[model samples]
Target: MAEALIKKHSRTKLDMTQGPIMKLVILFALPIIASNVLQQFYTIMDTLIIGNFCGATSIAAIGTSSQPVEVFMCVFMGIGGGVSILVSMHTGSKDDESLRKTVKTSVSFTYITAIPLAVLGIILTPVILRFMNVPDDTWDLAVLYIRIVFVGLLGNMGYNMNAGVLRGLGDSSSTLLFLIISSVTNIVLDLLFVAGFGMDVAGAAIATIIAMYLSWFSSVIYIIRKYPHIEFSFLPKGIDRESLKNILKLGLPLGFNNSLYTVGHILLQTLINLQGSAFMAGASVAGKIMGVSSVAISSFSQAMSTFAGQNFGARDYGRLKKGGRIVPLYSALITMSLGIVMYIFAPQLVGFFTKDGMAIKYALLCVHIQIPFQWCFCVLNTILNLANGIGAVRYSTVVNLLMLWAVRIPSAYLIATFWDGHYVTGGVSISFVFGMLAALLFYRSSHWARICRA
Candidate 1:
């Protein structure tokens, strides 16, 4: 009976080991794409409400908090990525026992790691804000917002882990469904707390945390009721040494890479903060816009990761090779199209966040400079994720470290310090281009391919 249930659920999963490659990739990616867009939309709405109701300082507060939050959450996201890949591989090979073990171990690991991380994040909120050099006008608000949000990190991590498991099982739609519910709830709460109640940044943070908990709750229920074959347990007996080792071996490099990447952003954010409130606010809005514009590429990269993980696990090199070539082309076309739209409307989009002319101008400039290079990002992300999916995580980590530390961060600092006044932000944009190109060159050299094949 359990085997029958497993087989029934299998019908919903995309068998990446065989299929019409383009169609399968698109079908797999579209829901993920919608989920990404909706997630970004609610996030944008959060900023929008804060900017409109709470003012520019509030906008800066939320924006500045993002880097530190990402830095702290990097390990959790890395583990989620690792879990997704492992589960996908097991699903591909139909290894039920290993799949159940991986799920249980991932759940245990997430809880163990998230609790301390949350406490640390709350305790260090002020220090992180100071390190980022948050403007005095915005520092208090940033601290308040970050502290409240940090309290909910466990819920956020829980949802991410469960969603990853679903995605690994080729059940992307379920994740999307839960995200839609969460996004709607977030927007409603944002309006009520920030606009109706006049709560400011704290309200926004509370809304976000509440929404995160809702998603986490829904995911836990779904997994319990639907995925009976996959054990969902947090008890000591559920822990397995081999499973833990496998997850860490695959996850830690990606975690470190994410931490390295966030460190670079923190450095860049500090530099941007030095440019004053207008520039800081502008950069924050620009970051949100860029996230929206790049959702397609990001979604497709995630899809590619799952696809590659499954095919590699099954040792189906031919399909993996075909996907390698076709996926990038599709991603480039979609990203290019979206990038052009965003560039054309850059001013209007930035205006949605702030009416301050200087803020809008800086934000528009950022969009103009970055959107043209969207294809480079698409290529870079897709290739790296593919490397991750194939368990060649170490190479991806090295590539990310070199690109972020060696290229992006230093270039941003040099431009800010030595370059002419008007060119600093543009120079930062150019660094992204260089970093992507470096990654693309390495990918083209087939280094990741060799690693995966071996």
Candidate 2:
């Protein structure tokens, strides 16, 4: 009966194989765009609460506190990426059992790892902030916020993996629903905890943690109930060593690549810290604002990965190429337009974080300089996602990692050291240029296409 259910809803039977590339790409990409953007909205709400009610010090504290968490979150997301590609391949092959096993194992692994990490994070909050050179003024708030969020790492990991699994199954709508709920919950809690209770940045962080857990639990329950294809025995049963090994192999590089990429940002954050608390606070707000652009383009990136993985599994190179071209062109246009809108409204937008004139001016500068380069990254990411989908792991891993350390880090160091009056702004803009160029070079290479066909 279960087998019959699987057959009835098999991917091939859905007839996704023969669509116009643009339509198919849009179909796959839009829900992801909605979900990803909404996630940024949740973070924005957290910032807004802290910035408005708790003050700029709180905003800076929360923002600075979030970097390591973001690093860990990226790794968790990378693990989900490994699971997603596996599921996408199995999905295209009409192997429902493999999907179920992958889902179970990945979920189990996430839970096991996240809980311990969260505990460690809670214990290490002060130590981390001290290393980051968080100012004495912001240290208390930063430690409070980071510790709260650290304790909730399981929820964060669960949400990421849940959404990744849904994406793998070509079901982005469910993920969107969860993000909507979480964003709404986050905003309401932000207001209640920070504004009403006067709990400050810690309150905002706590609110975010509550919403995250709620979203994760809701997604897990819904998937178990609605997606019978994914529900299965939780216990380890005749574990597939090959599948497990593949996931580890893919996940570790993907996770390490993500971490290494963030390492450059981590270093940049250190540099920004040197400029004083006001600059650090302004940079934090600007970076959060930039996360808005990624919402749309990153959605396309996720879709490209899933589409490529599925088509690759079916050995459908035509569909893969079609996807590669369509997603980049579409996402680039959408994100570029949004970036322009954000740039135009930069003064009004930055004011939400602080009333300080200098902070607002620097924030606008960051916006103007970063947006065009961000547009270029839309193209870069699509190609990279496609590479991941087709199991071109080494190439994608190498491209992103090298760009961060070799091009981005070195360029930032040189610019900041030699360029008089250039500041963090110059260092960041130059780094973006180098990273974007590296991505384009990799995308243009024949090797990526060959890997897709492999």
Candidate 3:
């Protein structure tokens, strides 16, 4: 019965070792992508509300301040990633007891870590905003928005941790259900608070925080009630320090590197801000459009990781190779299609976020620059996901760090200084192109597969 349950619940939910690899992958990724895209709808609404009702500066300020908070959130994601790697491995190895402990400890660490980060965010909001060189006009609204999001850090971390564990168990569909419900709730609240009540950015922040907790709560309950195999009480008596250490050891560098990558983007954001409100507004709208496109890519990448991790854990090298080949190909094809759509409809997409004609025009320019690289991102992300799932999180981190310093940052700096073009657009677009190329090359290297063997 335990074995049956194991077979039933493993990530991708179905055993990928059987049947056509593409069919399994698409079936697994579709719902996860839908969940991810639905979750982004609230962000879309937030931008719409802030830009239309509260105006351009509000959108600019909030978007600017968002960078650092995102860094903190990415760290939580890293912790969750570590937990996921361990759970995936244990599930693959059929170690039920160890899986439970990993889940419990992961949740504990997430809660503990997130609280301090939240408190720090509250205290440091103004200082950090200043560091980003936020203009006097937008600082107050920016600070308010960032502070509220900070207050909800625990919820963000909790939800991500629980959902990560679930996905590790091969239950992507369940996580999707929670996200869909929460996303709907978020959209409703966003309309009520931001558009209906005119609560502005504060209202948008409240809607987001509330939705995160709801999703987290629902997932926790489901995990406890439906997935007793990974419940807290099922934790083994003999804690495996080595096992836990291995997870964290591989994951921490990735976490830190991801955090640093966010900082680099923040640096770029600072440059964006210095260009004034029009540039910021344009960038914000462009970012939202990009966010919409990127969601599908991210969903597929995440599913790929879970699928690859399970096969890796089982020592099913044949299935792993099938996954390694199929995922990038599928993701690239999908992204190229989306990229074409984005290129054609760039104006319409950016228009949804704001009415400012100049904002729309500049945003279109950024979108054009970005569309060509969307497929490249698909390839890079596919590689990263595969690396992560196969226990090469450290290598993934190293590649990311290298991409940032060697490819992205230098390209951005040179473009900004030499071209007399707007730093914000040049910085973002140039780095994106270089980073994608470099990432694809690194992904093709043998080191990642070697780590999987180790």
Candidate 4:
């Protein structure tokens, strides 16, 4: 029975190295897209539950806490990206031993980093919140939520690492299955804890942590039982110094790029914080709406990363290049269409989060100002992932730094400071467009092409 299950699971991995480009991209991307949409649905449900039961302040607290958590979580995510690239390459080359070694090292690395990072996150949550200038009214709840969420970093990191491994193996369906399970669990728990028990922000955080662990454990079990040939284990004996070195070399830049991007957003958040609680609430809700709206683009970008990674591993540069072009264009069109719908219904969507008229008004303004330019992110995510997929992860770092530091942050600060403070959200949204333009220019410079050719 176990052998049969293993064989069935193994057969499910899509071989990206051989397929019609569009068909392969869509087939690989659809399940991932569905998973992302479901994940977004549960997240929005959490916000809706909080908004309805716990009020806008609780909603704002979760929103405020989410930024710092994302900043910290990006480290693990970047490392996972590194793991996926290396694993995909090895898999493509039919180097089973190397693939197994990479998986072990990646899992070991995730544990080593996650433990300390969780501790540091717990210790630093308050300080980071202060730095973001979290308003007095929202402070205590934000702190509680962040601390609990930080404690679950191990689970979050574990799930992400496992998902990266599956993605590297060209098996997004398994990750999707796990995500659906997690999302459903989270939604039920959110309703029970926050709506039923009235634990408010703390309940939402707890529910999230429990869901994360559930997903992580599911992924771990699936990997162990269904991929016997991979020898999945976290034993210290699995650590390979050279593999670690390679992971860091490819991953550190990607990780830093993500952290740096988050840093830019934190800076923007600080500016938003200065605008007061109503704006904070509005911006918070707007951010979530935008996230939900952009799910398709985000999913496609991730799919492109894995698709390109496998092709790169197989040295199919032609297919990689073709995907690099096609996927971004497709992503942009879909994002633009979604942006239009979101813009038209911005008020209704924002209203779902709060009854506060002021909060709804400001949130509506944020959506109106930002949604039109949302397509730019599709370009940015697609190109960056393509670069990461081809082992030119460092180029992604450079591109992100240039965008966030050189373009986004400075523009946001100047606009918020010199212009009207009310324009801060718009400023940040416009900055994204500018940053994506810069990234597009970098992509067009053919620098990545040169690297791939060499």
Candidate 5:
């Protein structure tokens, strides 16, 4: 009776299925947006520090180094998406036992996957950098940063899995607190290690690892304290086959797609590399600026997934369909508004990173090409996320794969080969429009419904 009382009193429920749809989405998304903003701050700080202390080559190093880890991490993170969707569905259906099992399985999966990937990342860092044809000036910095990050891969991967579970439980608020702690920890450490200790790119990487571990540790404590009934292991006990099956069924296609997609990015990074370090540094700075708008775009998609997950699980097709109409409109408008502001302030923002004239030129050019079409990508993202929530992941996977491989990459190559090698970023904008159209078609066909019934 005491335990039951504790469970009832402690659980903070934001029932996504029952509330006013728009209000609930905005409320959930706000915390996620805040969290993303805080997350972006630390990322920007890393670049700002590198650009200031170590110079443009280091800035390019950071950019090129990240892709190798992202290639592996994206697969695991995609699986975490499966965890969130399942947890949300279970919450909607009020299946306590299965929810507990899914959490345990995710914990186990994280360890099993993270260790192997970390080892592989450490091994491949040098090889991958060479493949990207990293400039001689930036090569050593890129290798150092990539290896340091892989060494602490478990912490970052664990935190992402924890965040997925929290979002699934309709508890975005706790994640904001976690990000708050990590962001502050990261920025302070970045300053102390880089500025005070003169550790350079190595210092930036070290600061990031420590922050990631702390973030993951804090989340574990919070989950244990707040939900005493749901137990977890710091050292994963083992994977549960039944639970793993469910998660993989929803998650594997996503993992495969993300892995392939990031591989495409690695190839794209090769393209960025061929342009030389100055252009690469410029694109990196532009990415940081564009990352601001992506916060809202991603937050909305995540929030809608959680929202749609609950409604779909509860079999509230009406509410889910209703959101399919209203939420995308809100997402597109808000994301586009942010794009306009970022576009207006592009010069000032670019100035914050570096004063190198050529760097500034390439950065601003990429920004100009991408920012105006940002809304199109947001629309596609929101719709795909909605499909994901309802177990229609395979279709979303197909859409993403085609958008990257057939449309985006080909367009970039054709532009470079024929017209202007410098304007490949235009391909990104073209793909955004194409993806938006494809996503709309996916929704209109009600493809997700067949998947749901199956």
Candidate 6:
């Protein structure tokens, strides 16, 4: 029955298993890279508009709000990652029956997980903020932003699930349209709510929430028009047994890792909070600047994973081996090029976020410590994506855990306690070196090498 439905399949624009590795990877990565830029641009606009209109305290509020939101969002991101991996493999093998089931189960999983998490997030927002040691100045704004955003969490998770299906089946460009529309919607609403009506951080949150639903709805309409086999629904058909098993097999570890990973970050955020609101606002600004600079690392990671997943599924070991080596190096070079540009223009870029002198000072301090070594992240990220593409995730999960628990958290605390707290950004940079070294071992002893040989 499921196989019969797949007879209406629409072939992906680029088949991963058949192409020049470099050309195909770049073609596929370009849209994803562009989408990342749009993400950063809107993010910057959020801070720029808020900092200008609402003051530095609001920017600090947003910075505080983000990690709590990420804690809720990352678990579903892992589910999306797992869905894409399975879809790529199933597509590569031309297993239509399993592919259909995976798509169905993905919708069910999203519906099941998202609402409960969202409710939990909203209810716990104040307590969570307090636990993070959010000072009185930024506390109320953080509570308001987080709760409003949580209202749209279901739409955001559903959109990701839909996008994951397309990406897994080798369609990367379509989501770019979704992002553009969302970006436009967000900016326009920001002008109306924040600028015109003076809604402050509340306005920014509302604007982003509306865009989230629009991205999900637009993705649904596109899927229905182009690939009718995919019908994205908030109310799913009863969970398919085989698909549930497959999803859990990959999804659970990845989901737990993502959730825990964000929790680890929340601890780091606590360290940042202790530095005061001016430093918090500055670090937030630096993140936006460096986010754009480091986009290539993440963009290529997604592209490489899809490419590797499809090839691995098709038993095209040659491309897998080749891409694993080539893509990471390309990503590193691109990252460094952007990092150099950001490093040169740091003051101007940081200034673009706000006029506050103290915030600019601390933002530059954070950027100087972090941006120079972003190339290391590129290498580590692409390597793990290679492993993810091939459905060999345990080692990568372990690597991430070790980097956070063993390296980042301890180092961050020690640097703040013993050394100049201004230099604490060095903690993440130090972990990058550690993570890169650990990721390299995936190629050395992992079953991916054995799978390639077999």
Rank ordering of all candidates by lDDT, starting from the highest: 6, 5, 1, 4, 3, 2
Question: Which model, 2 or 4, shows the larger TM-score?
Answer: 4
> In candidate 6, where is summed lDDT lowest over 10 consecutive residues?
1-10
Off by over 4 Å in 6: 1-12, 230-234
Of candidate 4, the 10-residue stretch with the lowest lDDT total is 442-451
What value of lDDT does candidate 4 attain over all alpha carbons?
Answer: 0.83
Q: Cα lDDT for residue 53, model 5?
A: 79
> Model 1 over residues 1-454: C-alpha lDDT tens digits?
9899887767777888887988888898999999989999998998889888888878888888888899889977988899999999998898989999999898888788888999999998898889998989988889999999999898899999998998888888788889988999999999999999999999999999998999998998888777888877534245788988888888888899899888888887888888878888888899889988898887888889999899988988878877887898899889899888888888778888998888888888777777888787788788788888988888778877877777777777787778843345554566557656665664555655564465
List where candidate 3 sits over 4 angstroms from the true fold: 1-12, 233-240, 421-423, 441-454
Off by over 4 Å in 1: 234-237, 420-423, 441-454
TM-scores, each model vs. reference: 0.96, 0.92, 0.92, 0.95, 0.97, 0.97
Q: How far is each candidate from the true structure, as Cα RMSD in Å?
A: 1.8, 2.5, 2.7, 2.2, 1.8, 1.8
User: For residues 362-398, could you state the per-residue lDDT of candidate 4 as single tens digits?
Assistant: 8887888788888987888888888788787877788
Write down the lDDT that model 2 would get.
Answer: 0.75
Better of 2 and 6 by TM-score: 6
Count of clashing residue pairs in every prediction: 0, 0, 3, 0, 0, 0
Candidate 5 or 4, higher lDDT: 5
The lDDT values for all models are: 0.84, 0.75, 0.76, 0.83, 0.88, 0.88
Residues 90-185 of candidate 5: C-alpha lDDT, one tens digit per residue: 888878788889999999899889999999999988888898889999999899998999988999999999999989988898989988898888
